[model samples]
Target chain A: MKKLLATILILSLVLTMAVGCTSDKVEETKSLKVTSGLWSRPEEQQFIREEILPGFEEEFNVKVELEVIDNIEKVMEAQKASDEWTTDVVMTHSGTMPLYIANEYVQPLDSVKDSLDITFMDAFESATTQDGKTYYLPISADVYLLIANQKALPYLPDGADVTKLTWEEYKDWAINIADAEGAKVSFPLMPIKASQYQVGGIGLSYGSEFPMINSPGMLSAWELLGEMVKNNAILETSFNYDNPVEQMKSEEAWLTFYHMVPVGDIYSSAPAKYVVAAAPAGPNGNGSIAGAWGVGITAGTNNKDVAEEFIKYLARPEVLYEVAAGTGGFIPPVNEVIAQLGEEPKDIIMKKGLDTLENGVVSGVPASEYTDWGAVKSVFDTVFQEMWDNDGELAKDFLDAQQKELEKLEK
Target chain B: MKNKYKKWFPYFLLTPALLYYVLFWIRPVLRAFFESMTDYDGSFSLMFFSKVINESMFTAALRNSLLFALISVMLQFTVAFMMALLLNKKFKGSNLLLFVALIPMAVPPAAVAILWKTGFSTFGWINNLLITLNLIKEPILWMTAKGYNALLFLILIDTWTVLPSVMIILLAGLQNLNKEYEEAGLIFGASRFQIIKDIIMPILKPTIITAVILRMIAAMQVWMISVMMFGYGRVPFLVERIAYYTDMVPMLKESYKMSLTYSVVVTTIVMISVMIYLRVNKKKEKEVRI
Candidate 1:
């Protein structure tokens, strides 16, 4: 009995280990493998699987398998040298699109582009095209917005419209709230949350380009943020805050700036309890980062025709609207969808984002310009830390010193 | 033929383990070493090593990792030893105490981090409790800790989560300890502290060494709790840098090489640390023998 038990245990262990070593066999069915970094939430995935892909699957008589990966570019990069292409189509964001195009991990979608009769917005068109070739077709655009609890309405600066407040007015508003209550104004300062975009948005409002590390406008932006920090206007827990929705829900933070989806999440839950508006303007204009997610075919895909068909299907006006609605609230880049938008709560939120994009000084994805955007984000994080550490008082040469660091990264 | 088969059966049993190690362990280490030494384009290059050395956070990560290992291991061993000794003694409700003490061992590192993170936030439960107790007029900004303060905060949280595991190991050792050795010390009129110092400790040396070495290695690789609590850059560690390279920016051509180099560096450090510790332990053993 002892010997039998030992043999069984060893056999079970070996079998478990062998399971991982076995290669998955390729299936012979008519299938489309779509790897997406967007719409990854469980509910969103369910909606895509049940609501969106069934129509395509039924029409083409193919099994549309949707796999949501957080960093599809890294996966594609790993698979770049391999000939066994597992992914037929990729849906990823604008920041990662540059890497795919530069590495040629994705194929040029010019044929798909020429096939479509619809007109894409000029900015979206320019973003998707590189050296006269369209790499991906833009699906939807998203921008950050200001979300405030209704309790904070009383604390708005005198004569300051919540929608049209300038940076100085916004700072004063924060200061006013901090004085009456605890520090409640927050930003998602955690590294993983792409908080650098928020900093760049402020810098753009101050008349600098996105990721202009040592630009004079960036200096002013930093100084403004430093002043807020000095006044204890920013939440002390912002460093741990990757998303302010929970804080808002807990009433730990009453005012914040965050991505449209999370903001939509807050508003959609309790529309009467919160106010959503366009991000505040700076001296130049209401500067905001306009990010878009696009769909493209991987370079090594065997099913190019199917991938192209999938992209075209994703581009339909109604299809785009459904995607925007299904994946929370993102502004569709198509003109017809924007023109035909309704008065629903989510539509209002997307309209606010579009309002900022139309009226603000819009910056393209900063990663598009830099070879190492992570390094750029590091610079911002370091400066933010220094600003916080010093009670928001920057040394005269601090920005310049950080600029030298940025230059080193560029080299 | 049956005698030969019986003689070779032991070797046959070892074959599976040997193959597992060669395939899963040796292969990855060899691959990482090879990858770290080569350039992206496959040329032999020391550029990655140079970059890692000159990297701004490299020194800080090294210092923090070493300091965390040293401090946390020493602290954990001392507290866990006391708990083990206490639990070894017969007392009422001792089993309940042991059960409560072992509760934290069941919580995973990630969950431990979240539990403490929520507690340590500015307006979190800790502050709320303090406020409710009338201990302060306002909430303290526990999350704003920087430099050594942040390191110490992580150490405290790490200690709370890992203390139970270390104590349980020590408790097992103490339970297995021979009673006659302590009885002999007691008959000689030796005090409790002296009995523990002279008799119990020397006998439990092997077990203590095992527990300390295990805890020290884990402490050296501490990254998850720090990252989960403070994010990437705030509380940088050697393994955290590896994660940053591989997880944060794997798309960069240089990130893979940099992470592999960091892995090599970390492995070298851990190996050297364990070797030095064993050498010291051997020297101490020799001294006692002399």
Candidate 2:
């Protein structure tokens, strides 16, 4: 009986120790909850795991529990419903920051602006609200560009100048190259349905000229896409970045308009297969829309100080360059970081595309103006798809109908 | 006192379930009804319902939802009945076939949507096969058309996913039926079709009605498939529109109004269906006595 009692006592002590050890470890980890859309990709995950997390741990002595949310709206809903704002940081599209600001879901970083040495003065000048408060750090600038298969270049008209070609010249060159190679050129037709990235690019291109679709420049943009569809020059496939990259590798497509960042990966993987070039100038000159993905601290986070420090760490020039260059396709949003990354072959190509964004226009429309752009995209997608079916005239009618419906919201 | 204690024991045992129903289901439904009358966005308000009712999109969504529910349920029931009949027979690999039929139900809706998307793409297997067989010289744009085409695709996918559940319910109903009646018909020189039409179907009426009611209730909230395939407010359905209004509109009153409208319509339809089933069963019982 005494022996059994001793065994029980020993077992209980051992169990207590194990539990205590685990609890101690959990406490030491200091799991800072970071909510972001950035860590979704495998490459981005690696960068976080290898570089960002280590640097952050060494500086702040806190372990971050990064929750990579797939949908930004869902994250915001969760944050709002919970009220406590459990997440410490959020990374999302710059287009979406204004809605968060309007809703009071996010706190302004005005308090920590100076200590962090963040160039908030300039960054705020560009991305701040009318009330003079900055909400997000502009991290990487995603610009859409025309990428070409090097094999098709030989078939282009002599002195064709693919980079600066007029819309007509570009079309002619694509048709000529496609005919000679017996392969089609592909452009994302109504890509908003598949990915917001493509839609942003197309919207930017259109918005640059018209700012709103009613203008003549917007009409010409539509006409160009319609003409491309009619000519069979552009393949009516979802212009997924990966799809075009694969097509270029297999030589199935001679050229395609795509985002510049993902093209770097394609270049690295198949160096001999493809080359990158700027999107041929639109009618309003070479206007490309710029998409910036950035990080922001949540409003009610307990670790606001650490979160702000992490943001600074992420925004550091070297870290930005490493993420942009090491990950292959991404162009650092910071001009100095992009310049510091230096002029390697891929860097030079990315720099040429980045240069366009420096002068390029972005949608200056605040997020509050469009709360349900996803729903709007759905409406536009149906219209665009229908237009593709009914010889493109239907698009204008659909757009007009959509504008009427959208105008109700503005009212 | 002892007798009273015994009587109160059952109520005590039932309290948890009754409380659960009140808290989780009944209260929300009542709140939804109240909000539906007012224009509550997602908060307290009274003017939103008027705006919702005034919107053309609401009417269009209601019409589309009714049509989708009616057409999808009828088609799904028919297909499920045929599948249940086939599975009822004792053939080799019959269980395997039933298992395979249930695969769509096992697959997540999001995954199924993506799979269907790939299959429906221009360079997808279906188009490739059609081209190989010279069925069409050009690839058919399956998802691009307005009206019936998009709705039809959604219906087809919904039916495919829900058919297994319907089949299982019907199959159980089929098993519960006495084979003696069908044998009596066969013995009396009734053909197989006559046995099914005259004997089996009438007896199976209550089960079939129950299945139809269940399917209709399920189909009325068919937002996921619609949103996944056609997107919100594009080929709008009642539930999808409610989701849109809730997510898109900042006004709490408007969102609540739309949601309330959806609940009322769905609940009314379900109650009516149950009432009709009860009425029909009563009539059948009266006829038997007569």
Candidate 3:
């Protein structure tokens, strides 16, 4: 009887201690973090460090920490886990955001829907909305175009123009440039799976949209690219090239398509800056393939309200222009704020990128996870790798087999 | 009472390790195996393994991984065995040379890879030295080399990093060897080469097999070097493909099944190899006894 009473006393004491230890600690000062895979050196990342962070800290009396996670895989893995995300908000390029939305990894911004003051372009409309919910908002624009060194401009065909050139004309121009000085054209590759994001635009010009990789239009595009490699018009797979800009400076390669951000920097370092032109026209049309980045609160975040407030603060027209200018993107949706930048001749890169965005018809498909477009991207890269291995030869049977593989992915 | 307490103490001490083994190792393996047999919504399905085999990259990844393993094992075993034979001699600075060789073993694999990358870049020492020697007017983009050339440098880098440990295993085997047999052979007027070939090699067979198998397994898992140095689709390996499916591609369920297939294939190869080695060794031992 004595032993039973003692045991009861000990159990009660332990239970009381456990309850005391479980009390929640009050969080006095609110803090939030933003993580994104879209971040790169200079421009927008710089603007975020110098302006947005300080502005938020001063205005809301809240501390904001910015993290640049270059690896999208890590960010996605975190989204897969049930634990609270390391950051309250996450951002990715428009092409990738759909996966997060489809997985329900991000919270719908329905409550602050009216607060989205910026009007997005028609192309972005599908990118931002899904199943009647706004999973992403436009932040900045990144457009791909042909950036040629001034020295190579003389080699352009007499009738051909940079603003409007057929894919064949573009090839002729590249071949002509090489013939002039025996220097190869630079075709930039991101070296890994990330190449899919950049090269998907090439397929866009061929009328290959999301889940439409195996189309005849894409076959023509890859064949043309293969011919370029065979003709030595483009850099070989084993070339001593690190980046397009560096190759341009060395006079090894003076022509290729690249994001306007790095192409604009040639002005400061070299005797002349690059001329950004629309990407070569495919059989369908010549709309520049554009990628954008935007911020959205994660569904697992506890501080949704604060994250929304921050997103709103960034979404304002004035703030957007500042960020767009810094990121060298033709600001969100449209360039309504380009005039606000006063006068900086350096804005030409953004202006040219904007011109392409404005003029060309966007032929790419809207981003959707259901398409499992990533598999299609892998298949495309595999073809190119095979071509490189076979000395620029792609067998018809191989192409057919690959297309059949892609056909199976269609919904 | 004290005797009863002592009897229970050993079991109490083993509790944490047993729990760790079950929770950390056994549970995850079981979970992965089970998950592979299910669809995304957790319904039981075995379609994924066949789907993995059908994927375009599977054949290439498996072929590359097996080829890499074969090449790496042969090169490392030859180099390490030669190194062990040399270091076993009574020579000046032998200990210091061993110390220098073992330094790579202390560094992490990722760090070692990064160091090699820095040294092999276009502007790095390797290219610069080659240029200085007039080996070639232009730099070779080592990562972009086609076919076997790209793999050649990767094998060198992997061997450089792992050679020391391989050598150590063989050296330990040499040290533990009884010198009496070699002396007996010498007394019988057996030549040095004859003694080494007929006796020393047969005696060291188990150690050689152990080192070769360990190296082979490590080689089969060759991924970071290939992925980091070359890239996706450039030099795909089995493990690298699994990473691409799991981390880069979004087909989570499909990737799980692919991994299940991958693990099964690799595990089967290792098991078969090890079994063959043991069987051969046992037969040889029986013959020697007879």
Candidate 4:
């Protein structure tokens, strides 16, 4: 009986192992093959079927399957692993474009640049290149601006300039408003680490010649933030990037520095309730970092010509306007598109967005500014959180250490 | 002739499994060890291992990973043991409770991550309830805080997800225990707790050790929960570092080396846990024989 039991166990184990291996192999074989990758917002999936895909199919005369991978690193890794190029086109942030370029996973667009009439080609070219090779084209731009709750308009000093406030002036205004209305006017303490390019805004406000964290401007910026914290102008808890508009609508904060997307949505919902204006100018100048997304063709694509055409179509002014307006909150990257917007319905928020992009210090940092900036941010965020929560005094020390660590990447 | 045929039949049945172990398991382990020693820049070199060891995140990650594994496993085992003991008793709706307890196991890790993230947010349900009860004036940023709080949250979430599986295993062991041995101790005037401590626990010791070791090994390799809770380098777990290096760095050789080092460390911990279990089990067996 014992022998029989042992034999049965051995047979079952063999059967299970064989079945598992075979099933994995089968699934691998059956996956849909694609030459180009596509990424879009979850809401745009249906729209892609109705609008984007039909045109691409008709233009290319080839049926292409879309591979939707969310994480940026995974998309890069997937391209590396697969022998035959799977993604022909990829949509990614401007920050990640350098890694793709350095690894030679993205091909230059010079070959097809002459064939297409791209309205924003010059503007897009300036921001998306490394060493004279254009690897990506801009799809949309997002600018940061100051949004105010109309209820707090009465508290503002009669002659105070909202557009150009020194650090001291902005802090004093925030404190006065906070004292009058509890928790009503606050800056979001939670920094968005994923958007590394936004760091340029902080550097810009600090009067730094370069976007260096160790500069005196950065120290001044930190001191300004510390003063704000002491005055209760910043929230104790970190606020979500998407929730500030809701907070504004509910009268939580009178004024905040926020992206154009959420603020524009709030204004459209209740036009009379909120006013959006240009981000307050710093000691050096009125400047904010310009964040953008771009589309690039994957290197070694079988359908490179068709993919290039799609990119060209995406860069046209009309297409840019359609995507910008249809998306409902995004700012158009093209200068001509912004000029044409003068004919549209006038609003404080739309005008602020146009002015912010036009006047702000556009981020020129190469995508490869730091190799492990994510790692550095993760560590810095921990220190920042501690300082905010416990009133710790390690911000300068932490910044110094981070600068040392970042210097290693230069080697 | 019939005897020879039967002997060969068993060998034929076992051949596939033996081959599989050699090809998939043993070969990869050997390759990983060699790769760990080399500066594997896409290919192979011996200097890569030195580079990984020299990096500061390596040591930090190792320490964090150990702490996470130890704390999570101990908590999981204790909770699972208590639940298993409670379930071993006969009661109405006991089976229903067991079914309900398994719900966490059925939920995907990604979905559970999202749930924890929402529940632990600043203005989440937990904070809202706390404020309503006058427990605190403001929302506590549970997941965003550094050091102990973030680590504690991760462990709690992990324990919640894994405890049910551990409980089920211990419950089966309890059911299979010899009731006569316990009854005899009771007849001898031993108290309930005494009988449990002296007879039941000694017998259940092997099963408990097995479950703890399995859970420890699993916890040591934690990546998804850490990444979902705190992005790369924020929590600084070893596997998170490995993944970040692999994903973000252009140097594939260094990434492979780091991965190999992580695999070695995790494997070593698991082996040590198994060794402890074997040593304890041997001593117990010897004592019983005496």
Candidate 5:
């Protein structure tokens, strides 16, 4: 009987410690849950853990529940059942704006604007508005760009600037490099990931819009791509966009185009190896796939005032400065923040990204391309892969099929 | 009253489990089935099913899923059975060997996929090891390995991952065997191989079938390996496509249709396969209660 009592006491103490350990989450009753989509990489770890969590907890005297969910579906049934938002705030890309509006997941920001201090960039300002009502606050700005090894530029056509190559010149230059140096130009061909994104940009250059295939310009682009593939002008390494930095470091890929996030990633590791350049202009415009990432108050929040305070706190330039430096290889959305950030050693990438952003800022719905999450990505990727497998002959029929699929989504 | 209480007691005990099954399993599956037959606005139609059937990617992925599942079951079971036999001998350090073999099962699938991918990279450990050994002049483009070789690599990697669990199932069957029959056969001058072929196999048939059926479910869901190794769009599977449609691409109606189609097809395959297996072995099952 005595031994049983002792065992019970020990077990209870162990149970108490176990329970205490799990109570590390915000214990305060007045808490806010901000579920974000930004924490995709190790880059977000330090900023989220060291800065945001503690800072928000201390300043607001409220436990901030920070969560990272990659995909958040419309919780219609739950919303209807509970009649309350489980989440207070949401952070996501410009593409989600249409879905959020359609689903009524987010509320307008007009009520919270008086507390926000920084001025927004024109594109960001326009992006955050729907029917002239601000729905969210821009967190950062980013666009895709070309990162070329300096060694590969000598192979460019006579006086053809890497940043200003025309469609014809781009093809000619890549082929020339292939013939002269026995090295194929690298392109990110991972369609499901970033390759399709680059393809969208390439299509834009040829006067095609989103799902911007099946046009004459698109034909020309594919023909060039096919020609390159046929001639073995696309390096084996270039076919993978998963690790462009490794490709650059190994010299298996001399030139590639990707989002500015990877550009900063590659630059930070080996700044001397590559140069950042604006994408070449298409027939109608510089085909930059520009988009803004932002944070908004969820419509379901019980404590709208607290949620408002958090969004306002995050919108501060210094906080955003920490974010820009912390993870995203993005340009600041605020006008003053850009000037204030200046050209510090670390800010060079941000400055470069800013310059690129200013040149080719495609605003609002058009910029997002596929609103919500475009479902045809795998299909698009597969069609391209089939083309690659078949020496890029997947031209007309494949592009047409993909274009239809994209159109279905857009509709 | 006592008799009535006894009759109702079993049901009372089963109430929690029955409730759980209804809530989590039956309801979701039924919901998905109905959703799959509907438009985004919830109007019923057969158009979605017809579209999925005709969709070239869906057909191709389904075919691949079936092929992979068949191949995985055969290879995994054979390898695992052999390993289990070796371990069942009660050799020195058999416990350590079993523990080592089970390590792969503990590692997360994502981590396993990434580890394999890194090994197969251009300047990865595999190439470095090969160079050190002077095995070949040039590195193999393992990722771009087409046709049979690609399939073989996937089979090997997958087999490596689930081999121990399959072995454990078979080992339990082997251990539970009545040794009296084998000893009796030996005393009667019967050969070792003959006893295994006739006596042991007949008894273990049910166990083997159970192991294969469980393994077949996992095999049909191959996605991460292909995605990590071959990159996007290079290789496809049914469940992978469903996830793409459901999670990555959020067209509500289409995603629902995919979920319903996937659940129905998988359930049907499992049922049909089990029925076929049982029918074939029905005669082999013996009862000696004179």
Candidate 6:
């Protein structure tokens, strides 16, 4: 009788301990779901999973469920319509923050802002802030930079510096390249993978306000593009080109103005084979489309505290620097992280990008002010197509009609 | 009681399918229709429709889509029917030929685009082959094709991709056909061409209609190849424009309504096209009866 009683007591004790352990495990394995459209390449995703998230997961006693998706905006839009939100943190392009802010899809990051010790660039900070409220924390900044194949160095127009070429000199360089070889200058003109920002950036250099269709600077930019097309100075395949990395590797395109990450990708592979420079200057100054990626917490997230902590973690100098370095050497927006970058090939390229932002007239994405930035991009596409089809003719009447269309969209 | 149960049994069996269609198909269609008409403020409006019509690429998209559908369907059907007829003959290596012909069907649209893109590139294998054959001194710039030439290029690529599926359908119809009909035409002093035209064609009308309708709908939705081949504005199609609005710029406040409106427009066009085809075919059938 005593043995039976002791067995039952011991079994109950083990059962209680098992229940306790299960509860502890459940408490310890709290998950933070982060969905980001940035750094979504397989290698980048792998780095985030293997290198970046582990420390946070271990430190916070939370499992980081990182989802790298290209259509994060669509996902957030759907989440806005729902009563429940699954995503705790969203990392996407800085331009998309306004859409979320306008719809109240994301909560203010005051806690994160207060906690961060590092200084974010003023431009990046302003991009994510509106009406005295911070919507997002800018993680990294990117600019369009000029990447030239070393083979094309000889074709540089007389007395033109490759790093500081004016718009006319740039055009002359392209013509010279085309004259020497076939048309080798390229742009990422592929639909959806467009370089309207390049056009807009050039407009800035020409002293035109961006998203303004009919300005004199814009006309000059368009006319320059037309002249290049007329001379067959642009790659014939540029209409279908997206990232010119592969083309640059193949020597199919010798010179291009492209996003810095891709320029980093090519230069890092064979730094000696290519040259990275600031975007060409015009009358205004060197013009650049300054863009950045940012992270924010969803308004409807159940894990607000954890999400805030995660944002704080992301904003840490070490984490940001590692993320920037791992993800194709993006320029970290934080000053401290920028200070830590070494003299690596990609770092050199990124430093050049920073030099452009500092020296050049930088233009923010049209989405910062325009609600229908897509429509704005479409107008650019149509006008550019017309220009290309017409052998680079600057169709002023056509530009005026499109400008009216742009104005209508604003209303 | 048994008779009533029997009467209800088919409907009882169909309940799941009915519910599936109502939930999945009908609901989304209705939702799209309503959403397209509604403004951002949830007020009823025709602004989205008008906006889509007035959109810059709308005309190009519509014209390209229609032109692609009309030309591709007719072209695909003619070529597919000819190939099907040829394969229907009991010749040596016929099965091997069919297998080889069906190989393209195995390739997905995106892969097909890549294959053709590589071939059509300036210094691609096609140019190299031409050079090797001494047919040309320099490479022909194939990717520089603009406007209609671009459209034609897409049509040819699409035809190569979808021909096998269309051919297989017609071939199945030919295989099921009675041998006695062709024998009768032969005995009646008909030429091979006359036999095909008079005896075989009438019997193959149902299959031809099926093949053409399927091809027509698929052709109407031809955007991926064009996109993969030439990107967006270079060769805009109705579905491509829809993709541009939704997939390309889903963040834009106007994108949601614009995509839905484009969807409605495309659906309407597809429905009307099929109706006209059926109506014309029915009229021909009535004439034959008379």
| Candidate 5 C-alpha lDDT tens digits along A211-257 | 56677766766776777777777776555446476666666667766
Docking class of 2: incorrect
In model 5, what lDDT does residue A259 have? 75
Best by TM-score: 5
Candidate number with greatest DockQ: 1
Weakest lDDT window of 10 consecutive positions for candidate 6 chain A? A366-375
Off by over 4 Å in 6: A1-31, A40-74, A110-119, A130-134, A305-319, A395-400, B30-58, B89-96, B183-190, B248-258, B286-290
Expressed as tens digits, the lDDT of each residue in B1-290 for candidate 6 is: 99999999999999999999999999999999999999999899999999999986899999999999999998989999999999999899999999999999999999999898889887778888999999999888798898899999999999999999999999999999999999999999999999898889889999999999898889988888988888877789999988888777666778888998999999999999999999999998899889
Clash count of each predicted structure: 0, 12, 0, 11, 2, 1
Which residue segments of model 1 deviate by more than 4 Å? A1-33, A39-70, A108-122, A130-135, A302-323, A395-397, A407-411, B1-13, B31-51, B86-100, B179-195, B251-254
Candidate 1 at residue B86, lDDT?
A: 91
TM-score of chain B of each: 0.97, 0.89, 0.87, 0.90, 0.90, 0.97
Ranking by lDDT: 6, 1, 5, 3, 4, 2
* Residue-level error in angstroms, candidate 2, position B36: 2.2
Model 4 / residue A40 / CA error / Å: 7.9
- Give the worst 10-residue stretch by lDDT in candidate 4 chain B: B247-256
Best by lDDT: 6
Clashing pairs in 5: A85-A300, A205-A282
The DockQ-based CAPRI class assigned to model 3 is: acceptable
TM-score of chain B of 3: 0.87
The CAPRI category of model 5 is acceptable
- Estimate, for each residue in A1-411, the C-alpha lDDT of model 2 and write its tens digit: 999999999999999998888774453546577777664667767877787688778677888877776566566767778886778888776667776676666777665554554342243245534387767776666666677777777766767776665556666776676566543675544333333334334445544331244345555555665565566666544333224654555454668766675567666676666766776665445556555666777777888878888878887877877776766656676657764656575676568667666655444333345545544444445545655676645456666676565455441
Interface RMSDs of all predictions? Answer: 2.2, 5.7, 4.1, 5.4, 2.9, 2.3
Q: Per-residue CA lDDT of candidate 3, range B1-290, in tens?
A: 99999999999999999999999989977787776677778798876777767877788877787778888889998999889988988699999998998998888777877777766765556777899999989877664565677777888889999999899999999888899999999999999889878888889988998898898788888888776666665677877876776666555336557776666666667678667767988898899889
Fnat, 2 decimals, each candidate: 0.56, 0.08, 0.25, 0.08, 0.36, 0.53
